[model samples]
Every structure is written in structure tokens, then in C-alpha cells.
Target: MNLAVIPARGGSKRIPGKNIREFAGKPLIAYSIEVAMRSGLFEKVIVSTDSQNIADVALQYGADVPFIRPVELADDYTGTRPVTNHAIEYCRQHFFEPQLCCCIYATAPFLQVDSLLEGYQELHRQQDKAFAFSVTSYAFPIQRSLRKINNGVEPVFPDNIAKRSQDLEETYHDAGQFYWGRSNDYLSSKKIFSDHSIPVVLPRHLVQDIDTEEDWLRAELMYQAYMRDHN
Candidate 1:
């Protein structure tokens, strides 16, 4: 069975009511719920949240709220793995246990159904890998990165200062959208971005981390652009 677990806690310190907060035209979580539903990959699309409001929105968007997340697990310090594990445990008891689990982030407005489907296909294609996640190449070479100290700037890797960008290998960063993995690996707390994980590369324009008011605005603009061109 395939399950899509959306971990949207209510206690968002950065953006108030972030999970249910309106984005463009609907709740932010709605985009994730909709995309997961539209992808048609998951047997069950479940939202694991500590907020009744989020649950209601999830249900309205055609997702199931099997359980309200525990308070301790809903805290700020709680990481993604534990929240995902909690959802997996709930499924084991009340519903169908998932063989493949995909954790979709509520704040990820840029999530595309194709990407989720690609992750699923890639996971099965590379049987040796434990996880397949959304990723995008870094805009710049990390080897040529700079660090600011006082009023001066220093090279992070001074040795690579003179290396050409084309000569340097490309590195990718997590797109922070979704992760598809074996349910057993998730239950065992396997690292989401470890060596066992495979990358599902997405275009940079379709990736953004919605952490602040500015990010939300930027995402809206990008999403609008996406709608005009792709939708």
C-alpha cells in the first residue's frame, strides 16, 4: 500500500496559522492535499496534525485525519521522522499499513503531482535505495562559497577559490517538498537525506522554502507564474 503523510503542526512560530493560512486562493495545506490526491499514487492521503482546523481543511480537500497528533510530538523540537513514524504507527493499528510512505510538507506550495509520481517511480526503480526525495541543484558552487566575518568576507573553501564553476561538480539541496521511502526505513528512523536516499531533481524555479512572510509572497508570485504557463 502507498500512503501520503502530511505533517502539519499548528504551532508555527514563524507564520501564524501557517498550515491553514490562505495561500493565493486557498489554505496552504490545501495545495499539498490536492496535489497528493491529484497524483493518484497514494491509497490513503492522511494529514497528521495537532490542529482541528488543519484537520478540517485536510478533510475538505479530500484527505483523512485518522488521529490528532500527540502534544509532545507536536512541539517545536519534534522532527519530521518522529511525526511520520507516529502516523505510520496509527496506520498499523487502525488502517492499512503502508509499504511505501511519502511525507508531504503542508507549506510546500510548489509541490507538483508529477514530482510526487516521479519519486514513487524512482523509488521502485532503484530498489536498493531507502528513500527518494525532491531536490534541486544549488544555484552556485558551494566550494566557492563565502562567509562573512565582522566587515570582511572569507572563502569557505579557500582551496577552491580559483576553480572554475564548470570544473566543479554540481551539488543538490533538499527541495523540502516531499520524501518517498519504504515504510520500514521510516519506522526505523532512517535519515531522510542519507546515502541511501535517491534524488528527484526539480527545476529551481519550482522550489522554495516558505519560512517567512517574504517567502510566502514570493511563492505566490512564482505559483501564479506556474499556473499561467503550466496549468
Candidate 2:
């Protein structure tokens, strides 16, 4: 069986009620749940959350809330792997054993069905790989990055300052959207950023990290622009 686990803890410090906060027209998490269901990639779409309110919203949107996430696992310090592992074990005990699982983030408003499908296909194409997750190229070359020092700014990599942009290697970063992996890999607590994982690249315009109010505003603008262009 294929399972999709969405870990949405209630304690969002940066943006209170972040997981279920309204975005665009519907609840924020509704986007993730809707997209996951629309992808048709999983036998089950589960939302593991500590908030009853979150559970209610998830159910209202057609996602199963078979279990309320434990308070211990719902803390700010808790990571995605442990929450996912707990979900996997719960499924094994109550439902059919899941072979492949996808961890879809509740805050991923920009997540696309095609990216999820691509991750699934990549995992199948490379059986040896442990994971396939969403990523996107950095907007600017990281080699020329700057840092504030006292009253002045300095190049992070002084050696690369003189190098041409075309001469530098392109880089990418995690889009924080979703991750597709074998059930065993998640259970084993394997590292996600290593060579064991492959990336499902997304366009820069379609990627935004909504951690703060400014980020939220920027995302709304990006989403509006994207919708206008596509529609």
C-alpha cells in the first residue's frame, strides 16, 4: 500500500495557527490535502496533527485523521522523521503495511501534482535511492553570497568574488514541500539530504518558504501572479 502522511503539529511559533491559517481562499492545509488527493498517488492520505481543529479541517477536506498526534511528537523541537515514523508504525498496526510513503508538508501551498508524480516516478526508476523530494535551484549563485560584519558586508566566499556567474556551479535547495521514500527508509531514520536521496526540481516562481508575515505576503503575491498567468 502507498501512504501519504502529513505532519502538522499545532505549535507554530513563527506564525500561530499556521497549519490551518487561511491562505488564498481556503484553510492553508487544505491546499496540501487537496493536492495530495488530486495526485492520486496514495492509497491513503493521512493528517497527523495534535490540534483537534486541524483534524476537523483535514476531515472536512477529505483527509483521514485516524489518530491525533501525540503531544510529545507535536512539540516545536520534534522533527518530521519521528512523526512520520510514528505514523508508519501506527498504520502497520491498524492498517495494511505501507510499502512506499510520502511526507507532504501542511504549509506547502505551492506544491504541484506533477512534482509529486515526478518524485514517485523517480523513486520507482531508481530503486536503490532511498528518497525523492522537491527542490529548486537557488535564485542567485550562492558562491557570491554576503554576510554582515560590524558596519560592513563581506563575501562569504572571497575566492569566488572575482569568478564570473556563468563559471560557478549552479546550486539547489530543499523546497520543503514533500518527500517520497520507501517505508523502511523513513522507519530507519535515514538522512534526507545525502547522496541517498534524489531531487524532484521545481521552478523558482513556484517555490516559497512561508515562515514569517513577510513571507506569507510574498507567497500570496506569488500565488496570485501564478494563478493569473496560468488561468
Candidate 3:
């Protein structure tokens, strides 16, 4: 069996009720739930949420709310590790044990089903890897990036200032969408982006971390652009 666990807490400080907030149309979390369901990749799509309202929204969209996440794990300080670990343990005790597990984030409205399948297949194809997660290359070279010095900007890598952009190596970042790994690997490791993991690179436009109001607007705009281009 395979499991997909989405962690969503109600105490969102940046954007109130961000998880259930309407995105392009449905709730933000609804996108993740829908993709997980449509992907046909998991035996169960479970949402680990502290808020009953969020749980209701999750169930409304066909995700299982087997257990209300503990208050301790739902706090602002808590990260994905503990919340996911709790969900895995709960499933083991009450339901069938999952051989493979995927941690799908609640705010990932831009997640795609095809890419998710790729992760599952790729993880198995590469047995040496412990996990497979979404990632996207930076639009620009990071070596040529700048940083805030006391009063003005300074090149992060002074040596790269003279190097051609084309000559620089490309860097990718976590798309913050989904993570697939063996059940034991997830339960044992604190970090997912290790040498043991493989990256599933996604188009940069489909990758947005919507943590602030500005980010929400950007994501919406990106979504619109994506639809227009794809449609």
C-alpha cells in the first residue's frame, strides 16, 4: 500500500486560514487533494490537520481525516518531520501499513499529477535513492546573485561576478510540493534533501512557495499564465 499525507495547520499567521482559503477556485488544499486522488498513486489520501474546519474541507474534497493532528505538532514552531511521522505511525496502528509514502504539502496548488507519478516511478527505477521530491531550477545563476551588505548590495560570489551566466552551473530548489520515499526512510530521516534523494525537476513557473500575501498574488498570476499557455 502507498500513503499520501498532507500536513495543514489552522494557525496561519501570514495569511489567515491559508489552507482552506480559495485559490484559483477551490480551497488551496483542495488542489493537493485532487491531484493526489487523480494521480491514483496512493491507497489513501490523508490530511493531517489541527483544525476541524480544515479537516472538513479536506474530507469535502475526498481526502481522509483519520486523525486530528495533535496540538503540539500543529504549532508554528513544528516542521513537517514530526507531523508526517505522527501520521505514519497512526496509520500503522489503525490502518494498513504503507510500503511507500509521499508527503504532499497542503499549500501546493500548482502540483501536477504527472510529475507525482514520475517521482514514484523514478524512486523505484533508482533503488539507491532514498526519496524523490519535486524541484525546479533557478531562473538565473545563483553564483551571480547579490546579497544585502550593511548599506548596499554585494555580489554573493565575488569570483562569479566576471563569469558568464551561461558558464555558471544551474542550481535547483525544492518546489515544496510532494516528497516520495520508503516508509522506513521517511520515519528515520530528519532531512529529505540528502545525497540519498533524487530530484524531479519541474518547470519554474509551476513552482511557487505561497507563504505571504505577495506570494499568493504571484502564484495566482503564475497559475493564470500557466493555464493560458497550456490551454
Which parts of model 2 have CA positions greater than 4 angstroms off? none
The TM-score of predicted model 1 comes to: 0.97
**What TM-score would every model get versus the actual structure?**
0.97, 0.98, 0.97
Alpha carbon deviation, residue 109, candidate 3 (Å): 1.2
* lDDT of residue 193 for candidate 3: 78
Candidate 2 residue lDDT tens string, 1-231: 799999998889999999999999889999999999999988899999999999999999999999999888988789999999999999999988999999999999999999999999999999999999999999889999999999999999999988999999999999999999899998875788999899999999999999999999999999989999989
Per-residue lDDT of 219 in model 3: 96
In candidate 2, list every pair of residues with a backbone clash. none
Q: Which regions of candidate 1 fall more than 4 Å away from where they truly are? A: none
For candidate 1, write residues 1-231 as lDDT tens digits: 999999999989999999899898999999999999999898999999999988998999999998899999988899988988888888988888799999999989989888998999988998999999999999999999999999999999999989999999999998999999899998775687788999999999999999999998999999999989976
Worst 10 residues of 3 by lDDT: 187-196
Arrange candidates, best lDDT first: 2, 3, 1
Model 1: lDDT of residue 215: 91
In model 1, what is the error at residue 76, expressed in angstroms? Answer: 0.6
Tens-place lDDT digits, model 3, residues 1-231 = 999999999999999999999998889999999999999999999999989999999999999999888888978899987888888889899998988899999999889999999999999899888899999999989999999989999998999988998999989999999999888888885468789888999998789999999999999999988888999
* Model 1 pairs whose backbones collide: none
